[model samples]
Target chain A: MTDWLDHLLILPILLPLAVAAVLIPINERDRTLKGAIGFASTLVVFILSMILMRLAAAGTGSLPGSGVYQLGNWPAPFGIVLVLDRLSALMLCLTSGLALAAQAYSMARWHTAGHHFHSLFQLLVAGLNGAFLTGDLFNLFVFFEMMLAASYGLLLHGSGPLRVKAGLHYIAVNLAASALFLIGVSLIYGAAGTLNMADLATKLAALEPRSRTLVEMGSAILGVAFLVKAGMWPLSFWLPTAYAAATPPVAGVFAVLTKVGIYVIIRLHLLVFGTAAGASSGFGQEWLVTGGMLTIAFGGIGVLASQAMGRLAGYSVLVSSGTLLAAVGLGHDGMLAGALFYLVSSTLTIGAFFLLIELVERGRDAGADVLAVTMEAYGDFDEDEEEEEVGAAIPGTMAVLGLCFCLCALLLAGLPPLSGFIAKFALISGLFDMPAAELATAMSAADWTYVTLLILSGLAAMIAMNRIGIRTFWASIEGTIPRVVVIEITPVVVLLGACIFLSLQAGPAMRYMQATADDLLAPLTHSERVLSAPRAGSQ
Target chain B: MELILSAGIGTLTASGVYLLLRPRTYQVIIGLSLLSFAVNLFIFGMGRLRVNAPPILDPGGVGDLARYTDPVPQALVLTAIVIGFAMTALFLVVLLASRGFTGTDHVDGREQRGD
Candidate 1:
């Protein structure tokens, strides 16, 4: 079972870790070298991840279920195993792509804002990749901690009053989440006598009713930890402020962090408790759907209420998360596939928009400049106009910024001619189609509610974005063209370009997502693959 | 034994939750540490509070679940402890930085009216 290809599964987790460890000691003055090492590492990860994706597509390694890599050849239920399934592969690819873009964007200036930006960023990637690939529940907790620790460092990277305040709340919430995670894992192990996810799923299916109740309680607590990370409402009050406070590139990479929570929820819930769990089958299904709907509705309200662009962007993340979480709750392969597509679209757009906000705001005064624009209508603006005109450097910068913001607006609102629209369309179609047998009767109120929320949320985003876009771009008396370097602009374009590519290739993308959803819902083969894979380090 | 362990965990968590709800940064940090301790012990108890058991078997040997305490949760707890320690340090540093920057040790970094 041991082959050359077996090593590829670990590369995504290890390579970034190695690079980060190497970079940590190099003088802070040697930022150039750090950038080179960081860029090369991320690029290689992206490449390696793409190769893994190809392998996943072609069905290599231990897959058709999952490709299992035991860390030290100790076999399943005994050792830490890394799994490369369709879902994990897709997430790895997404993380690498976001890391590359965020890194490129940071190299222009954002990297200099902190002491060890590149190191922390790389570590964050390593943690994310580890989280996605690890096959044990406890390892999942460890990776979650790693990722959260890195994020705490990154969140406070560029220390300012706002950043510090937001970082405190962020730290507190996640620390609590981590504690819950430990308790959950421990309780489950106590009940089932296993830590491996596959083994747990198998064990959970046959557990006695009383013990199954205990496991369900543990899992519900576990779900709270993940839901908080995923930015579920009631537990997500800290999200907007924390996101709005972080530096652009950090915030951009943090886009995928929320999705990481979603990924685990989708993976864990369906696999452990889907059709297989006796008495506990679909244990948290009602809560997931109800809570997801509430979160979506609340996210829509937040989007409408946000006055600042950064805050708006933060709320956009909530909407994106809520959309995906609700779709996952639907428990239909079609809805999950559509949700997956939308997840990719929304994350890319939000990441790109976060990076764009800083660049677009660089030449303006604080957000009050828009207020200054309104004041100009009452005749007190010529001095500000002259200052802005003097600061203006690039003729095309304003046009480019406007165009990019428009595209982001379109994507975030799930508007047409782009991937966001296609994603929303697919999801709506699936909402109705997911319950094919029920189609003979009248459409359920829940289905109608989801459709209405999706449309209403889209409208909310469009209106808020248009309002900000007009205030920030059109209403401004002074045209201060943001002096953006190619390095900064390129990343935004590349990310947005991915959105365009996804739109054009929606058919194939949906097919891949549908396959991932199928793999997730029926994961017995995946569990078997992990249990049967030969120990790592063994010939 | 289960009763005693659960009682201890309950006390730790109850006190942790109480402190966690307090407004001061130091209180919250202590609360977090207490909570982590409770969690760590909880994890330790998950291996069934065995007094003497063989650790993880020598590599390449089959594991006999009956003869050994489950090493997986032990390994998991060890990793969790290390991570928890790192998080506590990070939180403390951030707490200090926040206190210095905001001129208050309040959790929100601003004083409340009544408090």
Candidate 2:
């Protein structure tokens, strides 16, 4: 039993992949069977991730379960290894949780739109888990490609003209990014002489200046690829369009996809270029802070400029990514903890929003939004009153959807009474209040810019959500109440309910997040554990 | 020899970038393929150019360590090639679908007025 537990780290990556392969050969007509197996697999992975998270939270000392699982009983820094600490475990649990909701939401008619939806979805989860858990730079690239391949299929699922168009651009841009990824990875390999992250951390400190410069240039290029995925402005023009055009359930899972980029950035940047890395300690820190603020500004403007609900949700994803990026660049332990909290809450909200948009837009005429926008642009007229007469009473479904929309809006805009507010509060306070006396410097110009942009972006989301909400729910001239299924709306409720739960349990969650932040800040301890883990049976 | 390899990578990259910015989808696909090829070579060259050396270690332990090439980049290049090939196939299919769906070969699915 203990031996089996020692191998628990591999299950999150392996289980979904096995299930996906099994699902691929099954008949697409066996929808019920496929759905059941997929959901069961995701649930089990979620539970496993939770167990792993608990183990990680307990501490790495004397724990055989949560540290490192070497493949084929090979030693670390030689064979591929999976390391489970607080951060990766948190990500695994979050991915599976979102997968459960997304898989459930897809069963309500979206699965029948195309073949292999369940298989691709499972593959996506497996790829995400692998990317999060792998401790090797090359392995990260492999998992990233796997994730991208699955995403390309999912984005092109439910083939429409719009989807095909967006799919072309998305594929092209990502291919270019992949090329860059290879260049960076190989460049780093050339300079560091080892691919294992822990091994590199030790080797990098002793590198000559010329090779270190080469490695930094490689990392900078690598950062571009990640930033493109994280939706940092300019590089992020493809994100909103591609995400908006995706089928809702796929888009819902995609809410966590951008976070993969942010994850790698935080992981590699801190692990490779941390305080112990001699002269390159703060390399790319300024770039991250500045680019993150710009992303927030761009996403805020995009949110306001967007006329479609799907695009609004997509831009919200950018806003979420930007906030996390800036928080990551700040390098404050408390701020990182708050950023992790914000990551969980905001991802869930944006995912629920994406799924809800499909159900809400179901009964409305295709061009009704365009008409509404044009009408608003032309100014209020007597026609508005006659349109108001068309509304008599709110149906039960519309009422529930409106309520969910309000919850999502409040969460996205960081309003009071939800986890979003708590996360932002924790984050801002964490920025201001330092735990150590020496680190308690006054807020710099950049910090103030970040705070100002953060608040302004939230305000922009509020205005956009309010405007779109009114147009969607109340002021529509020809809008009919969308008939939503119980299964469809339940996932949204569950996701929002999770946010409320997080808000209520803010104390424990923050503690866990702060612990994660501490672990992240202290990279040496992580490298030490990973590098020193014994081979199987040798211990 | 080093200069030649570098020049080859540079030319491929330049051509790929130029084609990538073209207005047509097929050109973009070809450009991506070229760019991936350039990257694969770059990754391979990162292991350092050696005249005649085995990438694998001899079980007899007779070979000098310095004469052996770094096997990691070779392995990495193989993975990169496989992924890049798969991606190119996918992009081709998507390109065809896009071409058929909108009845145009332009990257944006329709020809813009000015372009």
Candidate 3:
């Protein structure tokens, strides 16, 4: 490998951190300046992620699976490390794509609402990229803290009563979750005697049966922390409230945050406890599958029950997380590949939907105290907007909004001709095709429940989205046309446009996703590559 | 020594859980803080609680795992402490903000009209 390409792994985490720091000293009033710099930086992130994705797909080194980048020239189990494989690279590309759209949307006005908006946004991206790239368990905790801290700031960026209340709950819940994270990590470290993920995988492989129970308990506690972030049922009471309360762009970026939880679950569950785990293999699959199904059921109910646009988008996030979590739990490699595809498609769709909410709600009378607070938080005085309906504003906006709303509805509901349907088809079809095990000829009752809930949730999303779509578009014939900026509408189109592109290229995309699933399930490759590397430290 | 340390962590955790279950925001925040302290101690204890052995090794020795405390958990606990501190500050600000806005410090931000 060439020198620069060898350094590509660290750039994703470093570039965003550098840009965020540079943005900090710039004066807050320079919106145009900050927007330009942030956009350029995020665009670079997107391009770099794409390049890295291709590099990761075709092997970069002697290791057939991943290229481990040792930080500070310290290698293996000794020091901080970053790993770039198909999964993290795919996640990086997805994150930057979402960040690009959200940053563009923010430039129109949302970035000006509160203090340090651009800085917080960039830091959020940095944290996310770091979380995806880190190879060690302690580094994962540090990155998780970084991500959650940035999210807390971004969630309350606009600062209103609802945002404050929701942000308070959000911070409190996450703080407690962090405590659980520390406990779980410490327990696992104590039991396993290592913090590097690859090293832990090796250690757990040979762990005695007596301590196997202890390690299992640690992993289970750790799973609880991740599931809470994933918005699983019974632990997700705070998710919808917080997501709905966040500003449009913040909510857009946040669509990927819940997926971060799912990403960790997929990576760790398969790597640490896959077939290598000897007796502990397939640990917590039952809770994961059952809890994931219940979360989908709850999210479906929330989708049906929600009367507002933002809340619906929030529940849609829960639905996506639930689907992926349950698919991973099934432990079918084929279905997991399908879940990867679903993860990307659903995140893009819901992020676009979150951005679309503020635009759709723009034309209507501000609903209640909470919403009126949101309007003020968004920093537009209604009295001023009432007097000035600029004649030059795009008259095609309502039509565009209507089209985007319909597309989001189709995608979220997993209707045909969209990637959502293809993803779900792959997952459900792959479920029954699992290789022969005990009683393998017949579908289990759990499988049936998964299929039923999957279809029912899609139906619920379709109905709820139809209701909201009608309420926003058809019911607005007599209302004033909402004045949307070109910058704002472009992001919605580009995001939804990506979903359309996914549908068109589903053949190649599914192949790549399946490859990713294959890579994730086989732990020996990761452990071998990590441990066999020449130590970059004093050795 | 192990017994004393584990008992202390247990007591802190029990109190923390008790406070975390309460309705008031301040109490819950304190609960989270106390809970984090317990976790921090647990992490510290995970390193085997060496009395005098910091991780710095003699120049002649390499890979002598028994001579020093494990520096990894100590580092992990340090990172946790910093993050936990920031979280507490953020929660405190939000606590005041929510209290100012809702007129009640209830964690839910709403008062029960009948109760």
Candidate 4:
């Protein structure tokens, strides 16, 4: 790696932190300046993430600075370390991309609703970047707390009665989860005698049976903490309500927050309890698969039951998280690649949908949804029904919004001609496609169940989206056109446009995801790279 | 020493979990604080409850694991405490705001029908 590029590993976290610090002292009245600063820094981080992704793709263990970065010139296994690889870079890229959209969308109006919106948003980004990049388990705890703190502030942004109510539940639940996190981390440290993840991976292989069981117990508790955030079944009651109550931009970025939980689960589970870990390999895999399947089923029900668009969007996030979790538990390389693809596509689509919901809901009555559901239930009981032509003269803004809504529905439902379809297709094919040596065996029942649940969830999303979309666009033609700014709508377009681009470039994107999966599956190589990397000033 | 410490942690955690399931927001906040306290003590115990052992290295350039009380847990506990304190403050503020907004302290922001 080049000297300059070597330092780039930390910039994603630092730039956001520095920008947030600068924005903190600025008056809340200087909304434009704060928004501008936040946007500029986010754009820079996005660009840097792109470059790092390219670097990670090209390096492949041969190039310098491609993997492990030690902080403060300290050697790994003893000091703070950050690992930059295909997966981390991809997550960073996803985060910054979502942040840029949210920041832009927030500037239109939501940023003005609160004090220090830009600072909180930037801090949230910094926390996310830190969580994604850090290599130490305890360091992960700190970053997770940082991220949760910022999310608390952001979720409470634009506070009203509903937001305050939902924020209370969100805060309380996450606080409990954080307590669980500390216990898990401490137990792991006690058993393994190290906090660095790479070192833990190495140590786990040599641990005695009793200590291995202790470590496994710790990790299972740790997994529970993450599953709470990931919105798994029976642990996700707060998600739909809290997410629905948040402001659009905050909710948009919040879509990625659940993925962070899934990210840590995948990272730690594979690294610490991977094939090399004697007596502990593949621990908790059954729980993940079962919990994930149940989550999908629950999310599907939530989607169908939701009369409100915001809650629908929230449930969609649960479905997305569940799909990724189940795929990760399967431990197949092909399925993992497809899951990564689905993660990106669904995140972007959901982010755009959240932003678009506020716009779509702008001109309608607050009670319109309840009224519509009632009318639909009781055979259109309203006396003054319009018998005119169904197609009204759509304004340009409404036209664009309708198109975006259609795309979002298509993406969320995994319909044809979009990245969602390709992702689901890849996942299904990967599940059934065993190696040539095992061609005699048929698909397992678990695989069959996963495929059935996946399709059913998509169908539920399709039905719910169609119902809501028709109610908003076609049935409610009498509603006024919302006065949307160019700034607000542009982010939605950019996000949905990115989905289109992903579909168009499916070949290369799939290849990248496959490579990332290859890197993730091989925990031995990953740990070796992290543990063997020299200190910055040494050698 | 381990017995006493573990028993203390167990008691705190049990009380904390009970309080956390309460409906009032204030109780929830207290529960969270209690939980954090228990977790901090538990983490502190993860260093094996060493007594009269130096957390720092000896000046004579001898570094031995048997002589040193593991300082990493102390650092971890400190971080957890700081974050826990900040989170408690934030949660309290939210609780007050929700109370003010909804005129209730019930976790649902409204009292149940029978209650």
Runs with alpha carbons beyond 4 Å of true place in candidate 1: A60-66, A369-394, A434-442, A535-539, B51-68
Best by DockQ: 4
- Which digits, one per residue and each the tens of the lDDT, describe model 4 over residues A244-302? 99999999999999999999998988888778787888899888989999999999999
Model 2 per-residue lDDT tens digits across residues A1-539: 58888878898989999999999999999998999999999999999999888888898764573389888878788888888889998999899999899999999889888999998998999999999999998899999998999999999999999999999899899889988888998999888778898888777889999999988998999999999889897799999999999999999999999999999998888888887788988789888888898899999999998888999998999999999888888776668888999999999999999999998889787776666667678986645456545538888998999999999999999999999999999889888885566443667888888889989999999999998889888776565777788999999999999999999999999999999888888889889989888887774
Clashing pairs in 1: A73-A535, A73-A536
lDDT of each: 0.87, 0.89, 0.86, 0.90
What DockQ does every candidate get? Answer: 0.84, 0.94, 0.82, 0.95
Q: Which pairs clash in the backbone of model 3? A: none
Candidate 3 docking band: high
Scored against the true structure, residue A472 in model 4 reaches a CA lDDT of 90
Name the Cα RMSD for model 2: 1.8
Q: What TM value does model 1 have? A: 0.94
> Which residue ranges in model 3 land beyond 4 Å of their true spot?
A60-66, A368-395, A434-440, A535-539, B58-66, B113-115
Top-lDDT candidate index: 4
Q: Give the TM-score (vs. native) of candidate 3.
A: 0.93
Q: What count of clashes does model 1 give?
A: 2
Computed on C-alpha atoms, the DockQ of candidate 1 is: 0.84
A130-237: candidate 3 lDDT, tens digit per residue: 999888888898888888888999999989999998898888888888888888889898888888898888789688987778788888888899988999998999
Residues A1-539, candidate 1, lDDT per residue (tens digit)?
53567688888889999999999999998898999999999999999889888778766453422488777777889888888888888999999999999999999988898798998998999999999999998889878888888899999988988999999999999999999988888888888878788888888978888888889888999999999999998889999999999999999999999999999999888889877766777778777777888888888999888767788889999998888888887666668888889989999999999999998888777855447435545765554544444545446877888899999999999989999999999998887773567675746677678788889999999988887787677665445667899999999999999999999999999988888877787768778777987664443
Candidate 2 chain A — worst ten consecutive residues by lDDT sum?
A382-391
